[model samples]
Target: MTESNTITCEKFLPHHPAAVWKALTDPDLHARWWAAGDIRPVVGHRFTLDMGNFGSQPCEVTEVHDQRILAYRFAETTLNTTITWTLNPEGEGTRLVLTHTDFDLDSPMGRQAYDGMGRGWPHVLDRLEGVLGETPGFDEEP
Candidate 1:
């Protein structure tokens, strides 16, 4: 485990950065691939996505830099994590970067959390990619 770790997931989407950003920020669009519905990107706004018996995580959107970055605080932590999306224009597509950082991953509890995120992010991102192309996918199923 390492402190201040970064897990970056990249994808090439055949769409505009604004469109992708919309999907990342808009509640309706975000719910399609990040939770069990109910998500928004307004700063200081708190929302929850049902995780069944695993408990729902209430998250707050702390900061948003338009199409550049989105940061949020999870659960009861005073510390906040960020997901930076750098949209690089590459020919007829856009290169999307999803970076999650600002968490201590060296401790036992932190390690467990980081491990879970490490496994979860791929599937989440995959669903995101799928939804970008098709209209029949979800991060946690509909």
Candidate 2:
């Protein structure tokens, strides 16, 4: 069996889980933080993210647990990786964990993506924090 690589990033956001969940599921908010896509939390729902210069990549929601977890198959045919977002309430905020797995280290595309995204996820999470801060009521108690 071929070994794969996984990228995990954790960020502490001073927001509620519901708010974080919205940022993950809401198309407009998600686009601002990451890529543009009709991303819903419904399992098996298909969508495509506009990766700009990287082109559009197809994705499908594979699992969702309300405001807790969201997992999906990303770039299904090409990268064939899974992206999972996990939200855990910690005191007055949410600790968001992003797990990107299934990178074929042997392939050039996968290796490149793994290398690039390893550095990119942090910046993306930073954008997510910025978006949450700008959005009204996201930082407040629900």
Q: Compared with the true structure, what per-residue lDDT tens digits does model 2 show for residues 75-125?
A: 997999999999999999999999999999989999999999999999999
Runs in model 1 deviating more than 4 A are: 1-4, 77-80, 136-142
Q: Give the winner by TM-score.
A: 2
| Candidate 1 worst ten-residue window by lDDT | 133-142
Q: Which runs in model 2 stand beyond 4 Å of their true positions?
A: 1-4
Best by lDDT: 2
Q: Indicate the residue-level lDDT of 4 in model 1.
A: 55
Q: Residue 15 deviation, candidate 2, in Å?
A: 0.3
Per-prediction TM-score: 0.75, 0.97
lDDT of 1 at 63: 80
lDDT of 2 at 7: 95
In candidate 2, how many Å is residue 95 off?
Answer: 0.3
